[model samples]
Target: MKLSVALIEPEHEVNVGHIARVMKNFGVNELFLVNPKFDSKKATIFAVHGKDLLTKSKIIYFKDLRKFDLLIGTTAIYSNNRSNVIRDSINPSQLVKIIADSKQSICFLVGRESTGLNNTELSICDIVVSIDTGTAYRTLNISHALAILLYEIKKNSFQKKTNLATVHERVLLIDYALKLAKVSGYRRHKTSLLAMALKRFLGRNLLTSKETMLMVTLFRQALLTIERKRRKMF
Candidate 1:
């Protein structure tokens, strides 16, 4: 898996530098900073060997999250309530399981130091992850949390040699699937849920470019078939 780290509006330059150092420790080179508050120069003092990352990090927006084939969000706050799906999260080990065999490009998003990822950002993520503290103190330092995540991923997961579908291709396939769902008589509410559910299925499992294309074709053909039958009935 091609892994990247994205810090969403990081508040402290020290944390950014520390996280970058940890990322380099785990062999992760790509860093993305979204609307950061601290100066890159200040952070480099802490980075030591990872000083280049602070200088070379990409600045991105919230909408740009979709550019990643799989986006994993980190949250200090999570709930057991089934109704609260946005905060529902898996542990870092579970995250390793999800990406162990996939060649897809993945990004792990770390939120602000004080509040963590908001509901809107969590909803956009393919999966939300929380490190198990096994105690009352659930929140961890931003750099520590990021270190745990990257260490687990680097230790457990291996990059596979496969021609996986790009984020754009998978997104197009998802849109086509939603179209197929609408034509197949699924209710609007169900279609929305299907969109979320489909992301888990498509993102966790590795699909080759050819496999994704086949699925898209099947959806289009089904939609066309439904349209023809409807016209004949009219």
Candidate 2:
């Protein structure tokens, strides 16, 4: 499984830099930032040996979540607001079990320092995860929370030793699926949901190189067949 960390509108540049360094410490390379309040100079100073991660980080939007197969949202809000079931979360240990067995690109989303993720973002994520802490201190800093989650991910995550579908490959497949949905007369909203669910399934299943290749071929064929039928009708 490929692991990535995403910070959403982080408030402090120092935290971003620290998270980058922590990510390197635990062997995670992909770092994504969304509408960040990032200061390159401070980030550079904090990153140290992990400057590479800071340099290669990606800037993304909430809608760009399709790139990750499984998204784990981190929040301090637990038990108090169980009424919103979507915001209810699993602990790090449970998250470890899920990632270790899957062959997908997983992204852990850390919210802004002042406030954690809102209901809408958490609702879209595949799973909401939290770390257990002392009751007196319900919250942790962004980098601290990031470090703990990354450690758990590294501890029990899938060992990548075989050929598997890459993020690029998965994106292409999802594109074709959207086209298929369009031809089948599905509405845009329903098609989007289908794309989301399908992406999770593809990420969850560990496909070998050969198996991935076969899937790509099959999706391509399906798209071609649809185009041909449309042509003949015209």
Candidate 3:
């Protein structure tokens, strides 16, 4: 999986340069800027030895971000008023585990230096990630956050063996199971419960496509048995 870091309307050239330096340290090549405020000189000075990253970086519009498969936004604020869902931000180790099996291109999105990602920008992201900071001053510099997140991601990338199931395959398996339950005359309410139970059961096992297919066949057989019993009763 390819990983890229994206900065949305960043205001500080120094932060951009520092982030580029960090990206190079972690072996991350792609850098995307959306409407940045400064020119190349400011970034180059901060980049130090990592000037090539800034030179080759892709500056794109917000609309073009759709090309990436997964977008993870970063934020520091936790206001109840915000519409975006705030979940536990994964530590570097955990983040690596989550992406180990993912096949899609991943984008790490950082908002402007002055203010973090707004609600609307956060909405486009598949998930929101945050760095753990001291309560005395919870906010981290944009470049610092980028550096830490990239370091963790790179560390995890090297060690993880990617075998986790894809979302599409899991959905297909669930659909098949639901169809089988319906054919067996499971009541609508009962079917919902059953589906939930089955989902939990399957989730625990982390079913692969082959294992899921085997379960599907077994469920079909169970449905057939239920149908035969119903006919006998009639």
Whole-model lDDT, model 2: 0.77
TM-score of 1: 0.85
Residue 221 of model 2 has an lDDT of 91
Please give, for residues 114-195, the per-residue lDDT of candidate 3 as tens digits.
8878866765665567776767576899888888887776556444434444545555677778888688566776765555
The TM-scores of all predictions, comma-separated, are 0.85, 0.67, 0.66
The true-versus-predicted C-alpha distance at residue 123 of model 1, in Å, is 2.8
Regions of candidate 2 where Cα sits further than 4 Å from its true position? 80-82, 157-234
Q: Between the candidate structures 1 and 3, which one is better when assessed by TM-score? A: 1
Cα error, candidate 1, residue 77 (Å):
2.5
Q: Give the poorly placed runs of model 1, Cα more than 4 Å off.
A: 157-161
lDDT per residue for candidate 2 within 31-116, as digits (tens), equals: 88888887867787998899899898988988897667668888888866523565567788876755674667788889999998
Report the number of clashing residue pairs per model: 1, 0, 0
Clashes of 3: 0
